[model samples]
Each structure stands twice: as structure tokens, then as C-alpha cells.
Target: MSEDLQETGAGDRPGPVTATATPTVTDTTAATGRAYGGADPVPAASTAHVAGAGRALRGAATGGGRARRAMGRGRGRHRRTGRVTATDDRPATFRDVFGVAEYRALFGAAVLSWVGDYFAKVAVAFLVFSNTGSVLLSAIGFAISYLPWVAGGPVLAALAERYPYRRVMIICDVARMVMVGLMALPATPLPVLLLLLLGASLLTPPFQAARSAMVAQLLTGDRYVVGLSFQNMAGQSAQVAGYALGGVVAAIDPHAALVINAATYAASTLLLWRGVRPRPLPVVHTERRSLLRETFDGLGFVFGHRVMRPTAMVVFSVVGIIIVPEGLAAAWAPSFGGGSQVTGLLMAAPPIGAVLGAVVTRMTGPERRLRLLRPLLLAAPLLLVPVLAAPPFAVAFALVLLAAAAVNTVLVPLNGLFVQMLPNAYRARAFGIMQGGIQLTHAVAVLVAGALAERLPVPLVIGAWAVCGLLLMAVSVTTWPSRQVIAEEVARAAELNRAPEPEAPAPMPARPPVPAQPAMPARQPVPAQQVLPVPAQHAASQPVTT
Candidate 1:
């Protein structure tokens, strides 16, 4: 016997669900006519006959054994034509992502938390250096967090996909808060502090993935790009502000700075819980899938796809080259008789440029400026060499800012283009792979730059790195997708965004007029129920929009 389906209430019924060829009808109210003008009584035999006939008709319309088949040829033809029309007209806004009540709360919490994290880093580095009188140990303390992404990114990031995004975010935040709180307790052993920080770092990938996915869901269309740009700006700004504040706070008391960082995590957890709406967990077919294999699949989607591969690879290479200059900024600034403030300025310059670049690129519009990507990619590194002329501090700073702006003009648009190319389902995983690629490349670049700086003057090292970056730019341009490919990708993205046309309701069948019976002395009983026959053509015409 076929099973009856359960009913979900009205609000849950509105959003269209994925359809199958055969569906069981479960209109019990209609069957009993309790929902209609139900004063009339129906004969039991008439009601049974109507229900049986309706079931048979529905089965026939659904094509009996062909129920498991794919959508009909008409749907296939529509899909082949790829003629999706944009229907949803939500206006694009920077604030849609950045200004949402939830996002705003999360943003504020992140600011406090990020600043706290940095303060702890600064305090840890100073404490290590003072205790051991070794820069290497201080460096080790600073570098501890970077190791997690390199070593455990996939394993940790997998957690995000398995749970509800909001829950993952809140839990990660809470976990970090607890870890930092424990670390801040008096007389914490150095090893214990390092271990706690490592544990916190492990939470970042999943937390970040949850956050990224939420942004995609919250801000639809081109607003997603603006949202991402806001995040990029906020993250860079936080680092700058945090490090500067951390330095000041650490100088006063390392323990206090550590506690402040713990407090940031606690506040972040609260904001994320209160601000962000809860989202459903992603569907998974199997609980038995290997985490390693899943991670590899994420990598495959990013690197195996035609457009995504090149986009991801280029972003990876670009971020790496940029890091070479940033990583060496500390060493480079000293050559001009400047201090850590100069280092901070140099580090902050690119993101500041990135913020300006994002605004300009938005104004230019992605569709219009996409063609300029090849030229911008070529020009970015070529512009960086001006900083190597060893100009005065102010001049160097200005040059760095100009170079950063140029690089980000390329970056912001490229990022949007990449997002457009990615499938909606794989956005978070793709973002994870792309970010992981960037992090890995950055680590390598910093290592290489650090070694080079140890041997040569910082300016020479930077100039040489700039030349290498220029070569990478050339490589990026050579691999840039052709205009036709870019157009096709854009079209595909548009198709993904478009909503399908609603089907016209089926024309009602003409009712057979009840014959006027010979004046019946005996009262004839009225039928208690009537079953409406659904139109086969209308059922077949229902479209899949998304």
C-alpha cells in the first residue's frame, strides 16, 4: 500500500520544494468536504467511488512506472535554451550585508573579539621575548595561530558543514571565549597559554565558513560582493586597530591584555547568538563519509571547475605576492629609521587601498570593468617597485598606499567574478578552499621573504619580490579566461539568480448539468463530497525556477 504523507502547516507550504514526478495527494479536508459549505450530506458509496477515481486519475497522469524518470523533454528543452528571466528585484545595497541588524551585531562583536585576539598575541610575544630573551621564541608565539590552518584546516572546517551555520558560529565563539578565559587566569604556564591559543585557532576555519555562508544567504545578488568587501575592510581595519591597541595595552600589563582578548570572545558569542538568524543544516546523504575525502572534494570543486580553478589559483598567487611585502614591512621600515608605527602603516596601507579600490570598483561596476582585469593584473605588481626606491618615510608610505589601491582594484573585482562563477551550493566550501589556498601561499611567501630579509637589505629583498610578483601577474593574465568564457560565466550566474515564470492555473472543466428529474415525491439524497481532478497539462507545465 502507498503511504500517506504528513501535512505541514500553511507558512511552511509557501516556499516551493524540489518536485518529483509522482506525488501523493493528501487533502483529507477536501475529501470529507469539511472545508466546503458542508451542510449537504453525501452517500458513503458516492464518496468512496470519488476517492478511488481520483487516485486512479492521479496515477495515470504521473505516468505509472515512469515516475522515477527525469523531468520531461519540455523542461529539458527549456533548460537547454537557458532563457531565465530575472524576477526578484531586491535592490542592491552595501548595507544589506553590512547594515543588517544581525550582521551589525556580529560586526561589533568581531571588532571587540579581533582586537582582543591581537592584544593577546602582542602580550604573548612580549612575554615570550622577555622570558627567554630570544626573538625566535617571540616569533614562535606570534606564529602559533598560523599553524592550525596549515595543519588542521580541513578537519576543523568540516564541522561547519555538518552543523547549523549559526550554531557553529556561536559555539566556536563560545569555545574561544572559554579557552582565552582559562589562559588569562593568573600564573598560567607559557606552554599552557600556547596550547589554549592553538585550540582557539583551530576553531577559526569553521567559524569563518559559517559566517561566510550566512553572508551569502542574507545578501542576494550583487550585494554579496559589497558584503564581502565590507568584511575585507573590517578584517583589515580590525588587525590594524587591534595590533596598535594591543601594543599599548600589553605595555601596561600582559595579563590584562590577555583578559581583554578573552572578553572579546565572550562578547562575540553573545552578539552572534542574538544578531544572526538561525539557518538549517546543509543536507548530507551519508554520515559515514570521510572528512579527508570531503575536504578533497571541496578542493576539487575549486580547482577542477573551469572558471573556479583559474580564479582560485590567481587569488592564491596574488595574496602570496602581496604578503611578501607585508611580511617584510617590519624589517623594511627600520631601514628608513622608522619604528613599529611605520610598520603598522605599511601593513595597513594595502587594506586601506583595498577599501578605496572596492568602492571605486563598485562604482565602475563588475560587468563593465571585468575586461580591464588583464591590464590591472599586469599593472599591480609593476606599481609596487616604486616603494623600493628607498624614498623618505612619507613618500614611501604614499607609494605603498598607491600600490595597494592598484592591487585591490584588481582584487575586489576578481573576487566578485569568482563568486559569480561558483555554484550556490558550493559557495562556502569553495570559499574555504580559496581561503586555505591563500593562507598556505601566504605562509610560504612569508617564510621565503623572512629568509631573504635575514640575508639581504630589506629594500633589495622587497624590490626582488616585486619583480617576482610582476612575473606572477603576467602568469595570471596569460591564464585569464577569454571574453567568451567570461560572458558565458556571467550568463550562467544570471541564470542561477533568475526566477522561473509561474504556471497559469488549469482551465476549469465544464460541469455536466444535473438533469431535472421528474417531480420526485421521494427526496433524493445530495452527494456529500466531490473530488476535483487536477489537470495533467498544468501539472506538467510547473517550472523549476532556481
Candidate 2:
């Protein structure tokens, strides 16, 4: 939000970098409601008022303001404990998730789109430089690709709520297809091509927002986590393949690559249109206010919420640190004292590590992940701190691999948690905020590292960045939600999912004499409708790299 936040040129931006993984099932979480694989505990309490966990899904259709208030539930309350119980150790298989027809279609479309997008980023950068022979122009074009996420992510993502998610994705894909097609035409001017590229890039936030929202709908429980693992694998793999393919194809004919990029969208359009069934809109136009208001509210909820704010910073920090090696590979590779292939090897390490991390996380149960949380968080950055010693290529690669893997392990479940807590109404806008945060953080991290590399030794810069990252992560850990809090969230999700298959109106309760049970005090709703720049957990599969 591997889910990737795409940045052109270096192939660095992490997408948990856009995929969000769900927490694995456990007895503690199962106590809340265990939506699958077993009986859920019937609470002695009316969980409808159960803080954020209780009211989240119930509040979904209400409005963003209500959802925001519901999500704001767990702040400052980590000191308290919640009822926890359930048991389901069997992990959801990729086969189980992919068995859903719509997910297969979504996956197919997304794969084609990602491959094309990555390839196009490289091809276009080359085309820009070739046409004007200005490295500066080339860089600007690459930067421009990221502008949509920064400037209009929430706004564009907010727009997705106004229509069926499938339609938003389809429309965005088709619009992108037209624009890329124009750019591929021979003799197109650089300025025009750039504009076309901008138009195409701008569609990403909304498209991604829609896709993330849809994924949350299609997958639930451990199945969602498994789906994200696949997304992470495909996205990272696509990055390496795209960048490599783009270089070769651009060398031969940049326009030809552009044509292929356009074709992928065309094919994606067909896949989405035909393969996925359409669903109704999340927020009807009548329910929405001005787009600006929607974005503002979403921002407040995303960033200002107590739990999300800190977690998001942690996610951003981890992704920011893991991405450092890839961007600096060209200058840093020589330190390994290896042959020319060192650059390629070092560049590939993070994504490979990222994929490994995703797999490990999928295999790990929730309790273990929770146990691994703080230690691994520190390890992610701590492992990289030794780079200042200018270790051999093997040592450097190992350190990078270990660090990247640690980051992904923490993030996969976090991505899923964000989805589990938020009301559906705000998920798309939530993704927009996280996506923007990740991209912005990545851009800044890379820029800072690049600038520092210019002024100092590559190893020194990387080591220093990692040290700073370590410190940042230390602070972020303090903000993590307690295990008690997560248990509550899981239970609430279970309760909601088991909402008794809509029952027929019962004959007027024959025994009106039975007294209603006493319920817990309702929480005062926070001033509603705030969304922040992705504080951390991203696009519900869609958060910032998420």
C-alpha cells in the first residue's frame, strides 16, 4: 500500500508496500466471535456497545462519522482487560481464498495491472530522458507519478465510495488505458506524454482504494491474511520483473513497452468487467457530503485515532527503513567489493526478504505474531545498524534480508487489523490516507538517503538511517495496542459476523414481562469524521507499504 506503494526508478517503495494481512486465529481472538471454523461464545453482554470492537461493523452503514467514533474506542483503555476465548489453529490456505470466484478475477486483474504499471514506470522514465537527454526531467517524471497519492489520495479514494467499487476500478482502468495508449503513440511530445502519464497515475489512488475495499469484502478471517500474502508475493515479484523487463524493452523501444502497458489495462478491464460480479456502492451520493469534507473526516480518523496513529507511524518507519537499501544499491554496491552483479543482487534482497516475511507471517499464528511484535519491531531496524562497518556483500545482503523480513512479519497482521476495526464506509478513504502516508514517507526516506549518500559514505548513511529508524521504532512500540485490546477486536468481529442469519420478525414477544438485561455504559462518541495521513496499517490490503 506486498501488497506496494509504487515509486518509479529505484524500485524501492514498499507496498505492504500495499497488501494488508489479517491476524491468524487464536482462542483469545476467538472469544470475541470466531467468525469461522467453530462456535462463537455468546457474551453475557450486549457487545453492540462494546467500545470500537463492539460497535464497529454495526456502525459501518451509519456513516464515516459514526465509524470514526466507533474506531476511536480503544484509546487509553489498554490498561483494562476484555473477555477472550475460542480455538481454530488451522491456517486458511491460498486454495481456500482463491476458491472464491471474484477474488480470482480481482487477482488476475491486479496482477496484470501491477506488471504493466511497473514496466511503464521504467519505460517512461527512459523515454523522458531519451527525448530530452535531461536526467532532471527524467527524475521529475518519476516524481510526478507519485503526486496523485500525495496531493489527492484521500479525495480520489473518497470518490470511490460514491459508486460501486467495481465500477470505480473499471472506469479508472479504462481511463488509464486510453491515456497510456496515447502516450505510446510514436512522436508524442514529452510534455503531452507526461500529462497523459499524470492522468493515468491519478487514477491509482481511487482504483487501489476500490480494490482494497473489495478485498476486505471478499476475504475474511485468516483467509484475508492469506490473500494478502499472495498479494505481497505477486507485487514484489512484479516489481523485479517489471523493472528488468522495462529496461530491456525500453532499450529496444520505449513506445513498445508503453503499448504493452496499455494492453494490460485493456485486458484488466475485460477481466474486471466480465469476471467480477458488481456490488452496490458503499456510500451513496446522498449520504456523502463534499469530497473535501469526506477526505478531511477520513484523515482525522486515520491519523488522529489513538491506535492507528502510532501503529501507522511504526508501519511507515519499517517500510521506510527496508526500502533504503534498494534505492542506494547503485552507489552502495561497490562497498561489497563484488562484481557488477552486486547491484542487482543487493537490489533484489529486500523484495525477496519481503516475500519471505509474508510467507512466514501467514504460517505464524496470531499469538506468536503478537509475541514476536515488539522484539521483531526493534530487530527490523537494529539488524541494519551494523551496515556502517561496510561488511561484505554476503553480510550486507543477509542483514538486509533479515531486516526486511522482520518488517513484513509485523506488518501483514497489522494490515488486516486495520480492516477488522474500521467500519466498511470509511475503508476506501482509510486506504487513501495510508497510501499517501507510505508514498510520502518512502519519497522522503529515499530522498534523504540519496542526499546523505552524496555527502557521506554509503555505508555510513545507511547505518545512520537505520539507527534513526531504530530510535523511531522504539518510540512506535510504546504506541502499540495491548494484547487485551486486540482480543476485544477479534471477539467483536466474530460477534458481528455471526449476526444471526437475518431472522423473521418473531410473533410479538409473548412474554413481555421478562425484564431486559442491564447493559454496559455507552461510550461518548468522539467528534466524528476525521481521517489522517496513513498513520500506519494500510489499505485494508491497502494500507500504506503498507
Candidate 3:
């Protein structure tokens, strides 16, 4: 009678109470308003009995530490972690960009095209210089090729986005191929040759923009980062190979080099046509008007966004500052008692370092990249210090390589983040503006370095530029995003990306819900059913419930 009264009183306490003879997982901790069986919910019989008992006992004394640790482990286990993944700030692999097939083709084409273009440039410059015995004309030839990028890069790039990416890419490749063939014609005039090259340059930015857009479409999340890195690597490789091959061909016969470059373009066209698949065009609005407004909008989009603006600025400053040394390399190298070969080495150093940095980037996991910006940014400038100290050519080359590697490692991931942050509509326009900024920065670096070289010894000028580079790097370090904020943003972006898509509602009988109360007497205990491990096929078919 006393036991019955005690049980009745416990039940009448106006809180959840478990009264079954068999131990039931009645969520007692939740009833207490604060889960006391640890941070995790009380383990049911479905879980390992021993583990549950251990957890329950531990929670009784340790205030949920074990459950919290278990929760943390569960979180970690479910997470897709990697270095240079989409969520990584500085994604370094092609996987970061997503797996868009179009990007792969475009990437391949760009490699061939960039290499051919550079090779042809070097070959043509040498031929012009040799034929006319005028270095100014040679420089003019190179300058004319670049002028189109300055004048029409943004406009053309905008056009790239307006048309279908595949069509634009195909057309550009064909146009370039035709132009290269014309350049190889036996009776081509030098002025006409310059005009042809300029035309090719005029077409390049739009083509590049189309390719860039296609990349976004091809690879969604992390793939974008990976694609960008691959493209960057290809570009760097092209510059190095083109120059080397151009030098070789020029040594043999400039005409042969031009012919080889022309052949390469043809090969590139074929590769692009065959390798990439077609994609449906994005929605277009016919209501748009006013070119200036559109252009300004693109600029605004790029600079107005928080992450994009600072990122672009950092890119512009770092690239501009570093290029000063290379721009003045011709003058500097001879002064340092080495010839044009040394100039080539100086030009190549940073990229070689960049390749190494990229390799290292690929090896590390994505999480490290996110928390690493501060240290990496600071490390970048330190690499240039040896060069600033007037080291030997070998040492200077090494220093330049180190600096290049550091900068590239930072830039690759940042570029990925920038791409992800950009709206789909403004991608090309933004790229165009950024491309224009890059061109302008290059010219500025050259001009400044030239002026500085006139007043200062070449080595001192180089050192000063290196020092400036260090300062700029320091700014980037100081401006690194807060860890907590970055982590939260990354988590949000990942969640949004991986969220379960909504399903179409199933057809149902038109009916209203009817409530019924159950009779509660002579109920038997229900046996716990074991949950079998979910099969992959079944799991895939289960629509994400979010």
C-alpha cells in the first residue's frame, strides 16, 4: 500500500514519468528541461547497451562531457573535409570548381592556345627585329598585340556572356586559327601582321570570359576552385613553355616557329570542339538597356561586394607590386653583370615557385587553408627579403621563386572564394573588369619600374619594389577575415549548397483529418525493431528531408 502511494505521488508530480517494468528510453533528460545524460540524447536500447550504460553513468556525474564529445565526433564524421575543396578559401584543385565537362575542354583549349600565342609572339618579335634591325619595332609589335586587351577586353568579355558559352568558345578558336594561318602567309606585311595580332587580342578576352563562365557551369562547388587552379597552372606553364619554345624556334628559324604556333591553334580548335559538351543557355532578360549602366553595374558588383572588392584589390596590388621587378628585369639583369638569359630566369622564377606552392596547396586539406591565411600572407613577403638584400643571381632567382610560390598559394584559394561569391549574371562582366585592372596594373608596374630605374640603380629599384611587396602583403595579412566569421559563413554556404531540394507534392484524395481517441487497457509491450544499415540505393532514393 505504501509503495503504491509513493508511485502514485511520483506520477502526479505534473512532469513526464516513465512507469514501464522494462527500462524505456522516455527522454527523461529533456523532461528535466536540461538534458543531463550528456549533450547527446539518452541512448535507447537500439544503441549498444554497454555504450548507453557508460554514457548514462558518465552523464550522471560528468555533466554531459562524454555526450558532447560524441556529438562532436558525429559532426566530424559527417563532414566532407579536404584541402582545396569548394568551401576552402584557397581551393587549388580542379575538383574545387565542380565537374562541369565544358570547363575541362575549355581548360585544355586554353593551354594550347596560350602556349601557341606566346610562342608566336616571341617568334614574330624576333623575326621583326631580325628583318628590320630595329628593337623598337619588335617592342611595338608586342605592344600592339597587347593594346586590344586595353581597348576592348571588357567590351568583348561582356559579349562572351551574352552569347552561349560553347558557341563563343568555338567561334573564338576558329577565328584565332584563321588569324594564325594568315600570319603564316608568305606575303604578309609587318603592319598588316600587327593588325592581325591586334584583332586576335581583341577577340581573346571575350573568349576567355566565355571559358570562365563555362567553367562555373561545368563544376558547381569545389570543382570551380579546382578548375581555376588547373587553368592558372596551365596558363603559367604556357608562358614558360611558349617562351622556351619561341627561343628555340627563333634560333632555328622564326618562320618555322610561326608555322608551329599556327598548327597548335588548329589543334586547339579541334581539341575544344571534341572534348567539351554543350550546355543550355542561362535565362536572358530582353528588358535591359544602356551599355554604360551595364558596365558600371558590373564594376559595382565586383567592387561593391565586401569579399570581392578587398580580394580584387589585394590581387591587383600584389600582382602590380611583384611585376615591377620583372618589368625592369631587362635593365636590371645587364646591370647585375648578367644578360637576357638572367632576365628570362627572373621572369620565370615566380611561376616556378607558384607551381610548387600549388602542389603544396593540393597536398594540404581544405580546413588548414581557411585558418592559415594570416600566417601564409605574412610568409609571402618574407620570401622576397633575400632578393631585396642583393643576393647572387642564383639566390635572387630562388627568392623570386619563393615569393611567387607564396603569393600564388594565397591567390589561388582567394580567387576560388571570389568566384563562388560572384552572382551568375555578373561573372563575365566582373572578369572583364578584373582582366582590365590586371592589364592596367601591368602597364603601371612597367612604367613605374622604368622611371625608378632611371633615377636609381637597378638592384636598388628591385629591392625597393620587393620592400613594397612586403608592405602590401602585410596589409593583406592584417585584413584577413576573422576566423569565427569565416567558419560560420563557410558552414552556411555549405549547408545552402547541400540542402535537400524540394519535391513536387504527390496527388492525394481530397479529405479532412479525422481525430480518434485510443482505448488504453490491456496493452502489451512493443518489441524494439532493429534498424538495418541503410543500403546506398535506398539512401539515395530517400529524398533529402532537410
Candidate 4:
């Protein structure tokens, strides 16, 4: 409980973390999936879905400690004996995250890779359109980039668990580089080029998963969250720049764009090889289960765990809801009498909002992030509900931007919480699932919103989508695991992840050995007040439960 509520400010986490690459036995149980025991699933909300989500928004700008406590009071009377002790309330700076040489290497590699991938999309589309002269084939050619992720991203990502993350990243980059190089040859048939494109795309999930999973290893604790914000901001910027550059470069010469993409991969491979240090595999596989089976296990673990499941659901729902506005931007722009330029601006709002949000989230201190987690989770979607009124274009754009920012705000620290609770063995797979879910959710949400727009006003459909998201988040909050449970789980995860790396490696230990902790057994649940430490005065007093 103490560790869970324990604040993480700048410079709090110790040591040079690179990635979880060593093999270790896991203690996770099939029954609980974590050290902490969970309570019942919370039902749908009552009382204005927890006091008119509108009312809660009024205090949105309040100090986190005060706002969180206020929200906590309104919810079930969960005990709060373990006082939160905040360290320095400072936000980690860009220089702080980029100070490490390894992170800087990764930063350059990731940005270049993203830019190359986007450039390839435009190049592929241009090639197909020029050759086949069919818009559908051209679209399909461009969309082939996402097919592998949608189909087998988790399985591919699980491969990263079997080896050092550095190795996985490097090998994937090299393979992509070679394939894209092959694609640059004019002698290659269109079908062959498409096949090569598919092959290259297939490697993306593992490479990305490996990079994402090892992030905590490069930067520890609060710094990791700050790093995440930087990555998000950079990725958004890269997307905008990539597409613009891709348009110009591909228009001038598609083959040249392909060469440039291939060159980026080569550059990325070199950076990873030279700058990133290799480590032993994080988890040793005691038994060799099929990769598909292990992938399912990862899914089951995420969906079955109480802490992870609700957060996952909330995240997916929020993502799906938020995407509706972007998906409908074209349709909605007509309603407010927008010119083509205004429509373009409306379409750009999501990414613009996301970039700005990342910057804001980066500047927030760690304590405030954790304190505001629950509220922002609820607030993100609630901000979108205002679209039902059919506001003017300016108001609509502002609402969308604010809502997107709220989502980014919730995600940064939420990711840190995930890092704290997840054992090293499951990190890569879980991240893969998360990444896939985001992509799939965006696609589905857009399809649904587009379908509904045909029958109803775009604003009404978007508003309804947001309402659903809010209600689902309400369910997540009500069913959220107790602080005691979360605390024990975090402490236990931290302990297991801190285990020293061993020489040689195995794919994965199906279940890691559970580290011994105070009252962590399935049969013995810790009392709320006794979860960890207490104030000197409060330690001597008797406990009360409501």
C-alpha cells in the first residue's frame, strides 16, 4: 500500500535501467495472476454516473492531492491509512530524459524509423496508383503496412521476450533495411515488391515492442513517464513531418523515397548496434510452450488481472471514443460551413492536440500524475460529451483538442503505473497487446462512427460514443483494485524486475516465481491500514473499516 501510494518525483528511481532482458522465474499464479488479491467487478454507475461527471469537471484544475482525495471520498470508503509522501514535486525535463546516451540513440532511431515508415506508405501508394491505376489497389497497398500488426503483432512481439531487446531491435531493423533495399530495385515485379513490403511490415511489431518494453530499463520511475511524453510528442511530430515529406519526395520520385526509407532503417540498425548495450534475456523458459499459446497467456494475464483489465478497458474505450471526432471531422466540417482549409484544420486537430498534450503531461510532476490518474481517466471522455450540442467549428475544434489533451494527460503516468506493476517477463507482450488494441480500436471506432453518421447527425453520434466511454470508465473506477492490492503488486513487480541478469537466456518463464512479501499469499490478504507503513502517531492506533 505504501509503495503504491508512495509518490515518485524526479530523481527518485535509482540506477541505470536499460531494458528487462534477463531471464527470471515468475511467481504469478493462474488463479490471481498477481501478488495482490482482487475484489468483485463493479457494476454500472448510479448517482449521475458518480455525481454528474459534469460536477467532477468543475474541480479539474484543483491540486491533485486535494482533487483525488475529494474524488476518493465520493467513491466507496476505501481506507487511506498509508499516507502519500511526495519527494521533489518537479517534473522531469527533456534534458533529463535525453541526458543518457542510450536514450538519445533510441530517440534518434525511433524518430527516423517512424519517418521512414510513413514515407514508405506514401511511396507504396504512389507506386500502385501509377502502375495499376486503381484507387482501391493503391489504398490496399498503403494499408498493407498495418496488416501484420492487426494479424499477428502479439505473436511477433512475444519473440522479443526470447532474446535481448537490443538484438531484437537490431535484427528487425536490418531485415527491414534489406527488404526495403530490395524494393528499391526497378527490376522487381509489382507483386514481388508488394510481398517484400508485407515481409518488412511483419517485422515492425517486434521491433517496436522491443523498443517500448526496454524503455523502463533506459530511464527509471518518473523519468520513464517523462521519457514516454517525449516519445509521444516526437512520434506525433514525425507523423506530420513524414507525411508531408513523403508527399513531396514520393511525388518527385517514388523509388528515391524507397531508397531513403531503406537508408533510414540502415541508420537505425547502426545506432542500435553501436549505442544500445545488450543484456541477457529477462525470463528463462522452464517449459517450451508454443509461441501462440504464450501469446494467449499474455492476453489472459492482461484481461484477467484486476488492475490491468479495467485500465485496459478504460484505455481502449477512451481511444475509441476520442477517434470518433477525428473520423467525423470531414462529415462534421460541412455542417458548420467550413471551407476546404477549415476542414483540413479540423482534421489536423487530433495530432495537434496530442502533441500539445504530451508537452503538458511532460511538465506535470509525478505525484500529481498519480493523484490525478483516476480523475483524468474519467475526465478524458467526459470532455468529449459536449459535442452533442452541435457547436460552431471553433468550439468543436477546441473541444476535440481539450479532450485529446486530457487523454494524453491520463496516459503518461498511467503507463508508469503499468511499468511498476508488470513483471519483466510480461512487459513486451503486454505492450504489443496495448499497441495492437490502440490501432484496432481506432479502426473500429472510425468505422462505427462513419456508419452512424449516415443515419444521424455527426455530433449526436460522436456525443453518444463519448457517453459510452464515460460510463465504461465509471465502471472501471468502481471496480478498481484497492490501494493495498495495488501497492503490494507494485512492490512485488519492482522486486522481481530488479533481479540481476543472468548469462545465456530462454524465451520466457510461463510463470515467474513469486517473490516473498508480507502477507502476499492468496489465503492471507493484508489489512488496509497494515498494508505498509504509517505515521508514527497513527501506527499505535486501532484500525476502523467502513
Give the top-scoring candidate (lDDT). Answer: 4
For each candidate in turn, the TM-score is: 0.71, 0.75, 0.72, 0.76
- What is the per-residue lDDT of model 3 for residues 1-546, given as tens digits with 9 covering 90 to 100? 111111000000011112332222211111111111122222122112334455556665666777665433322211232111222222335453434555556677778888888878887798789779999999988777678667767766887667777788788878877887788786888877877888777888888788776665565433444455556776888898888888898778776777777787777778777887666556464667565577787888778765567778877877776677678778868766888788887887877877877776666544344344445665665666555567777777777777777777667666655654455577777788888888888998889889988988877777777677778766655554433233233323333333245887999978987878787799655456744456688876664331
lDDT of 1 at 255: 80
Instruction: Give the Cα error of residue 411 in candidate 2, in Å.
Output: 1.2
lDDT of 2 by residue, 167-204 (tens): 99999999999999999999788899999999999999
* Residue 346 local lDDT, model 4: 80
Worst ten-residue run, lDDT, model 1?
4-13
**Per-residue lDDT of model 4, residues 1-546, tens digit only:** 323222221122222223553222111111111212333121112221244244456566776666565565444212352122222234667887889899899889999999999999999999999999999999899989998888898988898888889999999999999999999898889999999999999999999889988787788645677789878988888988999899999999999999999999999988988888888878887776888998999999889876677667767877887888888887888899876777777878888888987877776665465555666667878888888998888888898888888887777766665665677889899999988888888888998889999999998998888888988877766666665455455445656767666878766868978888776556656666555555677777954342
Q: After superposition, how far is residue 31 of candidate 2 from its true place, in Å?
A: 7.5
Candidate 4 lDDT score relative to the true structure: 0.74
Candidate 3 stretches greater than 4 Å from native? 1-74, 77-102, 251-253, 290-292, 480-546
Cα lDDT, model 2, residue 196: 94
- Against the unseen true structure, what C-alpha lDDT does each candidate score? 0.63, 0.73, 0.62, 0.74
Q: lDDT of candidate 2 vs native?
A: 0.73
- What is the C-alpha lDDT profile of model 1 across 381-493, one tens digit per residue? 67667666766777766666666666676666556556555555555666666667778888889988899889888777777788888887676565555434543444454
- The number of clashing residue pairs in model 2 is 38
* TM-score result, candidate 2: 0.75
